[model samples]
Target: MSDLYEKLKRFQQNTPVQKPSPPALVPSSSTSKPLPDQLLKIPGIVRGSQVMEKIQQRDDAKKKFLSTLGVNEVTNPAGKYGYREIKISNRELPITKEDIGGLEIQTISRDASLAVFNANDFLFFDTETTGLAGGTGTTPFLIGIGFFDEDGFRVCQYMMRDYDEEAAVLHDLVKQIGRFPALASYNGKCFDAPILQARFLLNRLRFPITDMPHLDLLFAARRFWKKMLPSCSLSTVESRILGRTREEDISGELIPYVYFDFLRGIRIERMRPVLFHNVEDVVSLAMLAAKICRMVRHPENECRHGWEWFGLGCCLAAAGMWERTFFCLEQAVLEPSLSLEEWIAINKFLSLSYKRLARMKEAVDVWQRMIERGEDVFAMIELAKFHEHTEKKYAEALALTERAILQMRNRQNDVMANGPATVMYEELLHRWNRLLEKRKNP
Candidate 1:
């Protein structure tokens, strides 16, 4: 209800803000903003021939690793066990409900589902692909999977020696999941799953990815951390919620180039650092997932805002957890959107959720007010249909249809060319006229 900008200004004025460090600058006479200092700090950022030398150094490391893990002159136990002394023994960690399940914090212990979250079968995972464009052509150079076993949480990585060894890496991941139940990740839904799936199919590996119940911490980060921080990205979530920070290190963007260096026989030296970066990504996934779970179970401890609840609802909806979705939706609707478009989008989702639960009256009320606040064509059509069918108000329905046409005409008058909206407007006008005639006769 309060002005958002005013509220932000008040909060800033009240809170003792941290004083920023003095920024590094170039010697420029004019009073223009200096170029970023961080840009100058990039290591191994050399492209072309210098970058190729880095790859040769990495390849040399790979060969040394192979020599050290010496071939057995025997077939590996049904799968390629390139360099690791990985054994197929029954070596699960002691993950009882009492030890790992309950957090010391009372709020968190009470909220986590007693039946589902047993702590034994949940694993946190992350990956670094050759490139972000995941196809059969793209390969996962490294995958980091972590869990709390007997010796606290351990990050286990499966790394491909080169592009040629991608199959072995994917096979190990699919095999590892057979030993676990649920998996957790941050934005793994968008990037990790598809990459793994493509790799698996190419290798003739059968992985039951769809069957696995995944908790994408990206969704949870949005829910539990959005109020605490504006960005729900993993690193931000880790910093803001968990009170942790990663030291300046190699980024994921450099990884493909790191591999390309290895491939080109140049970066024989930097593979160690590249592997170090991959290992850190896996470790961060574990830490970030744990941080999110802690916040979700104890919303009070975190001072979460309304957008957190909105995010929570979205997470629950994606997971198909209806009861939890209802709880989150109730919270989100309390804090209506700050802008008309934001309100309409939120209200639209809320109305659809209500509709899913057979709460037609609630859905109708939501759509009606939603249309009044922002009379887009979609809202008008939905409201008009509801008025005609549900309320037996043909006059009201016809009026809404006319309003929709006026909105369309205004939008077209503002159009630059024959875009998608123009075609939709032409179609919508004909549809509205047909609907109005039907209502008039009936």
Candidate 2:
């Protein structure tokens, strides 16, 4: 055994052992194919499944989606595109022209550059898009419009079946919008109309929504309710102004995901809530339009809150409806919730409205209230003018002028007094001289 072991060791020591070669650490760029190219060719690098699986047929998916919606699918004569459309009765929406006076639309839209748009020509429009950050890639899947007809208010929704079907939907929308002279939307001027116009340009279709006047209720709602609501979203406006709350509505942010799922052969049940959300949006558009028109028409009507009265007064003043402005201001002042600043502003407007109507007594009363509250130099000047010129009471005018001069002195060091104090100071001096002259002459 010792001789065998010695021979094996000698043989192993004499034998030459060859070393294995290490792999060549070549750089990735050494390959002719790029990594991204290789990755693209891979079936599914991460998912372990086929990448870019066959997409569902556009027409078939559309049919299935429409079937779930219980809406009719329409194809143009050219058969190049197809869309879905539905018309529901006013029962679905209880708003009528009577609910919003026909004349009131004319008044409310007067300053909105809709001079020619009448109730017959006003179209309430809303859109449901695949994304809120709208651009060329974002598509409006649904366009819902409402207008008054023999059936009261009829809402017609035109929905796209697929990306290719947008042309048909836009064509139908243009035809419907052509009948109306103006479009009323919640935020259409900034959001919906621009998106539709982009879609039309992308499709190489003529965008019929010309320079036509668009009444964006968003601005109006913000002007009136910004002080009252936490946010001026349509939902908040509907709840606060129209007293309508949406229940079981899908979150707006999830709509795009649900629509993409529908395109990928997911069940249509996911899209039903989205469609219902769109429907409510359209119906609420009409109702909100009517509600705003009613508010404009009846500025003197009791408002739900003090801020509403103040907002109405401002609107009336802008429209040159002095009597109505005065009425709204009077109502606003009676509200207990009015802040000191708002109360002063309302009284100032109220005094101006009264003076515009030659109702000097009412104007004087408003100024007296301002003087009692904290003392408004402008109000004091107006009261002094009334006493001196209208009542021919120089003594009373002198007293008011002297009081305003003293108040101006008190506010001289106050930083709040900008140009207003200078103007009031000059007016007070002019009034004092005039009162002295009147006393001497009388």
Candidate 3:
């Protein structure tokens, strides 16, 4: 009897459940491709002729779920998932309408389209997925969106109530996001958007999220805070940079298990935190975007920290805004807390910017500062070249070059070991000889 029961249990687990015929408008398992193996592994996953019945049951459950959270399901302009929007009057987020208004239009590497980006046209996008490492097997269960409105900021959340509702969720996302000129997310360029594209292809639906300017804030966050923060994760940026700490939040790693539990008949309350987490991510994207845009547009007033100034300077420098870049670098070098490496980097850009502005005195000052701080051979070489070529002070250049050569020898093979340094040392010798010849002839 025990062996017979074991055989029956194995058979039941392995057997494919019969799917109920769905409504014409609704996607059925037969027409849609099979769910991935990961999704199929959830216990009590809807199957059999009862599939339609379960869907009906899910509708009631979804109603209760949304009611418990005080959010309503929007089905109008149908094919929407559990979509709803909320307006916040006094949200503690950092972005304002004016900040979004001033955001500069930048080119996207992927799309090669350049247009002035309006914050109104940008949909702040984020996704909560069943798996982070994306493949065809993974699913995007929740999509969170935020945007600026006349009143303030509006955030919309679309969630998949069950595995079969993924198509509805995706379709609704496309309908909403496709109309927007661009999508902004923390790391959507590499992760969220691509995974979503994969899910779209797997579902045999048209991938509508494309060709728009994508502002992936992860790159921006790294540029701004990678030096100070231990990690560049959104949560880290939220706490460390944005000054927002999440409480009562569900850990992202456990989110998949929460969805799996819901499939296995767990109470809807368990998934509330997951929904809240997604909402927070979307809101944070908006806040971070506003902060970055402000720093870029008005670094002198907005950027407070030395590292922040340095980061903004690098961005301005890249954009060829030499005057603003110089000002930011000037502020950055005044920051007494800068690390040696940070100090060096800021001074290098500062000097370069000064040179670009034809301010040789300021450029020489930066190089001199670098040398006073430490025995930077690169700074010494730059200053020597400046003296020899710009100021025509050959004797001063010869003295600096001789000091570099003496230090290079005292360091015992330091210059000889580096190919570039060796070449620099030989060049210094040539400069010293040239200066001596000039002195002899004069």
Highest TM-score model number: 3
Q: Cα lDDT for residue 162, model 3?
A: 71
The ten-residue window of minimal lDDT in model 3 covers 102-111
TM-score of each: 0.54, 0.73, 0.79
Superposed by TM-score, candidate 1 places the C-alpha of residue 340 at a distance from the truth, in angstroms, of 2.8
lDDT string for model 3 (1-442, tens) is 9999999999999999999997677545456545675566675553643687876787687668777775666564334457667676645545676665423434111223424666777898888888878787888888888887777778888877777677777767777877687788888988888888988898788887767677888887777788878999999889987799888698888898888877755676788898889888988888887777777766667777898888777776677777777887888889988889878988887887787788889988888988888766777888888887877887888788888878777875777688987887788788789878866774
When 1 and 3 are scored with TM-score, the better candidate is 3
Q: Write the per-residue lDDT of candidate 1 for residues 242-283, one digit (tens) a residue.
A: 665566556667878877776666655566655555555555
lDDT per residue for candidate 2 within 1-442, as digits (tens), equals 9999999999999999999999989886684776776776765663443333334354466576577666677777423333434565667655666655445554555554675455567788888889999888889987888888766666777777667778777777778889987788888988899898998898788888868777778877876788889999998888878898777688888888888877766765677787778778877877777777778765545367777887777776777777777777888888888788878887887888889889888999999999999688778888988888889999998999999999888878762457766776887888799889989998
Q: Sort by TM-score, best first.
A: 3, 2, 1
The lowest-lDDT stretch of 10 consecutive residues in candidate 2 is: 47-56
**Poorly placed runs, candidate 2 (over 4 Å):** 1-53, 57-66, 77-92, 111-120, 130-138, 211-213, 251-270, 296-302, 317-321, 388-398, 405-442
Q: Whole-model Cα lDDT per candidate?
A: 0.63, 0.77, 0.77
List RMSD in Å for every model shown.
Answer: 26.4, 12.6, 12.6
